[model samples]
Target: MRFPRSSGLLLHPTALPSPWGVGDLGPSAYQFVDFLAAAGQSLWQILPLGPTGYGDSPYQCFSAFAGNPGLISLDHLIQRGLLSYDEVVEASRRYDLNADQVHYGEVLAFKLPLLRHCYERLREGGAPDMAVAFTQFCRDQRAWLDDYALFMTLKEAHDGRSWHDWEAELRTRDPKALAEARTQYAEAFTLQQFFQFLFFQQWLPLKAYANEHQIRIIGDAPIFVAYDSADVWANPELFFLDAEGKPTVVAGVPPDYFSATGQLWGNPLYNWQRMAEDGYAWWIKRLRAAFTQMDILRLDHFRGFAAYWEVPAGEETAINGRWVKGPGAALFKRLEEEFGALPIIAEDLGLITPDVIALRDQFDLPGMKVLQFAFGGGSSNVYLPHHHVPNCVIYSGTHDNNTTVGWFEDLTEEEREVIRGYLGRSGSDIAWDFLRLAMMSVADMAVVPLQDVLRLDARARINTPGRLGGNWGWRFRDDVLNAGLAHGLHFFTEMYGRLPPQPEPDEPAEDATTEDELIYDPVDLATTA
Candidate 1:
């Protein structure tokens, strides 16, 4: 989809500062929104907000349609009278909330119990209005919520084993066993729904606040669902599963410059023929749910939507995979019919084919460009700002890439010289230099990672693909954001015409001096006014 000429910062909510051992949809989130407004940012991009499983990767979530309970705010519950401030304070004492990195294991241990306590309070007839709202939320979201709540309750019963490892009756979803299990785990199931209710209860208001400040949110959605997810378990027939309910083929990428053996992502491949029988109903619902939380959705691995790499289930690496045709235009046609003019940004970064470019252009969706990739080759590199199209979204770096400074530090001296010569600078401030290149480019939108904005190095990188652990743990300190930082960023934003046009100034009184007039130079006044 075409976007406004604007810029934003890419920082997952997990990176926000809080005293709860993890960033959440609490006061700090609102403060971050305020920062975005002050910085003249028009977008707030985030990773997927789904509940993470074994690896704590947002992309591999428990449910495509559920919120991550780990992001719910207990302090918000205190305001609602479902939790007390003293209790929250006491709970905060058990974990290192001020740590620079997230301890996922400790966060889960600390959050789940308190979430359950809030659920119990609601069950005990506290907060009648919220109880009513919760009931309405469940009813409104029943199509997906019922299955997700049941799936989570069952996972807990089985000690966190994948559904494929469950008994035959439950694994295959035998009706009699399913009926009995629901009755026995009714409270647990309801509690899962309540957690979702609280997540959206806090999230929607935060999203609205960002919107009110003219800052649109861009949320991520993976092209493939995890094999162990509720979507796969609840609707096994939609995937290429064998008789025993295991995937026959999986998703991954073929060998490329990055890896000789290629990357094998063990996600279940979709049975496109089966899905088409119902007019791609599943994808429609998934996108519809995603739109409820975000203004624009970034489709991860956009090339996979045109043709995906399919490897037989037991393959050790992606070298043995073959390209298989996806649903392509038919799937997107159905989505557009449901929600017109798809507000999507395609993650068309790696190994893109003509067909993928065709698919993206057919929908007029914006693809991405990362400045970190530009200096690797000559002028023909599509990532270079000179070759950039006005329909793309530009970035200084992405979640998968190191901070711009770190990337520059690791480059060969010759490569560094090439970049410096191209930009006509000595590369003293690489992060802001990259940011300036991105903002001054013709791309419709530009987003810089918060780590790059903070001038952090590799130590603050958000994620590094293929690594098993220690990814998705970085968080920024609370003291880093200040008025000077906002003003500095706004200078670039305003100078590049990314900020929205300001209204004309009214006539000033004889002794009046407003904040804008007091702070800005006469040149700034002429430009802004």
Candidate 2:
């Protein structure tokens, strides 16, 4: 799955500014697409769009296949007559303007009730068109949607307790218990399903707009399922879960730079042998569903495909974990059989072994290169831009790392000296320097974080590794997207020959800017820079 030569910005929709407290698939999202086009970017990469749980991390979702109802646009609802303009105006008035972060608690309290109101109106009005569309969506996605709707409804009913803590019959998914739940909570289930329909309805139009502008969307897919998620509960046979629906062995990383005890993620480990027995049907379906929403997918924790760490379920840390061989080549072989060439970007980060690289190359997948990891050593370091191969994506830093400015500010004297010596600078404008390095790198694609572009620091960091609280809540102010920033990016892109070519002087701009007619520069950054 070869990609055209291009560049993009990494910004989850949650970070987009909106008056409704949290960003949604609304007019602001389309405005973001327009911003990308104006800045000459051809990609818009985002984190998973799933409903977050516990720590509010998108990676740890309630359902891998369901959309986050939190992201459904209230403004869109008003246009559709499901909600009134006054309802939206009142809801917007309730948000705290001074909070620089997303108040998820306040947002959930305010938004959910309004969504329920909209759902009730739809039901009372006998909206056959909406009902038919929702029924058809469910029928087309029954393989996963039915289970997800039921899981969400039950989770709400149980006061948001983990599925493992539900009653023994429901915990083990007894057939009788499931049937009774469906009957008793039918309305709740329908509401959850309707929310997903609305999310997709808004999202598809935004995706089409991006496509029309010659921008491709890259979406993230975590390798493991949350222990308490619908994926684990509905298919207990696919994970290392006990008969009582509790995990026996869990997922985590071995001791690495980020943690001395290693990170115990606590997600249920997959039953690879079982998955292989069925021709990896579950994985195929997961990847297929992801493809429907994104043009290319980034497989998080790609090393897990080669081998994974197995930690006992009750362990407080990952110190006692052991390495177990994953399904590896056989699984990818089957994926290729089902999906043809895989349009995947392997998140080949953290304690990567030769085997992981081997498996990644076997599939012709592009791995990632982070410039922050480069200056710690000499030019031979794999992260150095000069050492990168064409089959890679380069970043200034990832979501888990501090914004480049923050990272630079926190560097020790010795590390700072080393960086100064490497780049022959005294570390002024560290963020922009790194951003320029990334844009000039030889990797096939380069993605700059929105935080780095804004020259923000740790205060605006997206995620901090090993830190549990006060993460994933950062949001940018609307005024941050001013013309100066856009023009600066446009200048840099055009200067480096990374921007799509301008039209002929006599040509009409609209006709010249047809979707298929956009010109993407094909200079291989790996070879040129």
Candidate 3:
């Protein structure tokens, strides 16, 4: 699907400032949307909103279909009578004041119990409408939700061990064992289900607000599922798992520039042939569920659909991986047949082959171009602004990349010289320079990370590949949003013609000088890690 000539900010909700440590769908979210509208943005691109697991990465989620209940707003719960204002105020006191990064363990401990309290209060309130809506949501999503809730409940029961390590009866999903578990932990299972219901409830209203304001939400959908995820445990047959329900081979990449040994992602490889036999029903359902929640979708690791790297089980590194034939065009063909004209943006990065480009273009899906990749090579590099096709989304950098300023600062002198020669500039104000290049590119949509807008250094980096710790925890302070920064962004959006038309008079004005001011320095980048 063709997106309008629009631009947006790339900020995960977790980055938005809040008293609860991590951002949520609270007043801050709505206010952020208002900021977007004021700045003339038509899109609000975010990372996957799934329930994070190990390493607190959204990509490594417990369930692809389930929302992160941690993102549920405690203040909103108070307004709904599920929680009291005093309870929220007391919880806020425990949050770490000095740690800008999310302490997931601490945050989860603080948030989940409160959410549980809310769930119980709502249940006790006996609001028939909410109860009926929750029931309907469960019914509508039973294809995935039931298994996910059960998987989460069971994981808790086993103290968070991988499903393969569970008892043989549960690991193999013996019907009798499952029935017994259902009976034994019915209340816990219901709680898990209720959490997802609340997540969807909160999310729907936010999405509606975006739609009402002429903004659209674009969601990310990673191609591979985590080995320990609910999807794999619930339907082991869909993956290349042995009789013991352990992955015989895993998903990864061959030797790429990012790593000498490549990345052993440790995700279970899908049994494509098995999926094809059922006409890719699992994939169809997954996409359908994603589309229900998001206006547009980005398919991450899109090249995996063309051909994927297979690393044998028990391998410590990706050096022993081999390329295996993926389901390819046949899979997308079936998807289009079922869902019709998917509004997908192909995350066609990393060791892209001719076949990957062919598969991407065949479906007419928009691919991504990162400006950070452009200047390391000559103008002929596909990532260069001049080479960008209209059917692409341009970015200064993605979640996996350092903030553009940090990236430029980290580059070697030789690399900086190459960048200087390519852009015909001294590479001063590197973040804005890259942002300007991306916004002025021929790509249909341009997204600038909020960190780049603030020109933060490596400390504000969202994720680092191959490293496990100290990632996905960055947040902005409320004071970070100021008048000058917003004006500058508005100027760029207006000058580049990426601004969307205002939806209504009462809606925030799209003028550069009228809205709330955001203060940002071209060079005073934050350097904390």
Candidate 4:
């Protein structure tokens, strides 16, 4: 199903300014909703909200179904009497408030123990209602929560080592060892679950505020699971892993712009045959969990659904990979049978093939078109605005690209000429130029990275794909979100008819609807699904 013609910002919560070092589901989040409403944006897009593991990449999460406890608001915990203001003030002293990037290590060091302290308070029976709420949450989410909680508890006991690094019995998930670990680490398991509870409790209210302000969230979901994640650790059979819990094959893309050798993502490739045997149960659960926290979902690495690049384990690069067939239409058919409707956007970028396009169009799910990729060729280029169809989400750039300014500087003379000729303008305010083009396009959804709006350079780029460690750390100051910027965005939104209609004060938010808007309906197109 096509979304309303709307525009939004691609600012992950981590990019928001906060005294706590990293942005979170806190008061600053509510203020961001105010900013979006004031800017005439109807959507707020964010990266995956799962618990980050190595390199603090949201895409490489510890658990697909778990919320990032680090994003839980300490201030909210204080308000709930689970924590004290003194603790928050004390922890704030340890953070680098003036730094323009997130220091994930420092933030985690300060926040995790604090969350544990709050968990201790809750266990002490300081709040009866909260205890009941926690119990109910665990009960409702037991299907995934039980394994995730235990996985985290084990990770901590092993001094933050990967699941494969655990004792042989635990690595193999021997039944007796599992039972013993559960009995011994029961307290740790409770604390881990408690942290998840805090994350969801804070996040729901923030989502409600955004919904009330007419801004729907567009959260992300990666196509593959991390090898060190709870998902692969708990259900090894679902992934292509060896007996010792190592990936026999991994996930990545073939040669692309990011690297000559291609990016060896090292994520465990799915055993689609096994998934199909279970009716795609894990995929369904993961999607259902994502829906609880978002209105629309962006399916990352969407080409993988049609045909995935499978790299042999321990490969130096993704160059030595083979294209494997994914579940294709059959998997999506199963999802539709269970969920009724799917509001999804396909990230159909990088080394796309006709088969990928066929799969994307089959569901009528909106695909993405990044304007940065448009200058690579001519008018026949799919990313160009003129070629964009209404069933797509256009972007000036995404998290993986250099900022518009940086991209323009790095372009070859030939590529530069192409952009100037297509745009019919020189490089003055190139970021805004691209933004205007995207907003005015026929695509049903238009999203601009916050960096583009601020006209920041490459230094603010979020991720570089093949590179490691230095990505996903950029943050914007509170002052950058001034009224003038809002006016500029609002002006274009109004000009392009992307400004959402205001709902009456008494009406319920469109996002709060019970049933999700499915991507495919009974459109008896002679060719498509």
For residue 149, give model 2's deviation from the true position in Å.
Answer: 0.8
As a whole number from 0 to 100, the lDDT of residue 304 in candidate 3 is: 96
Where does candidate 2 stray beyond 4 Å? 92-99, 126-128, 500-529
Which of the two candidates, 2 or 3, achieves a greater lDDT against the reference? Answer: 3
TM-score of each: 0.94, 0.93, 0.93, 0.93
Question: Candidate 3: TM-score?
Answer: 0.93
lDDT of 1 at 264: 93
**What digit string (tens of lDDT, one per residue) describes model 3 on residues 415-529?**
8998887778888888888878877888999999999989999999999987879999999888877767778888888999898865577877554421111111111111100
Candidate 4 lDDT over residue span 242-317, tens digit each: 8788889988878876578887888899999999999998888787777767889999999999999999999999
| TM-score of decoy 4 | 0.93
lDDT of 2 by residue, 305-406 (tens): 899999998999999999999999999899899779999999998889999999999999999999888876576889987788888999999888899999
Instruction: Name the better of 2 and 4 by lDDT.
Output: 4
Can you tell me which runs of candidate 1 are displaced by over 4 Å? 501-529
Candidate achieving the largest lDDT: 1
What's model 4's overall lDDT?
0.85
Better by lDDT, candidate 4 or 3? 4
Q: For each candidate in the order shown, give its overall lDDT on alpha carbons.
A: 0.88, 0.83, 0.84, 0.85
Model 3 pairs whose backbones collide: 482-517, 482-518, 482-519, 483-517, 483-518
lDDT of 1 by residue, 128-245 (tens): 7678777867777788888899899999999999999998998999999988999999999999988888887777778877877789999999999998889999999999999999
lDDT of 3: 0.84
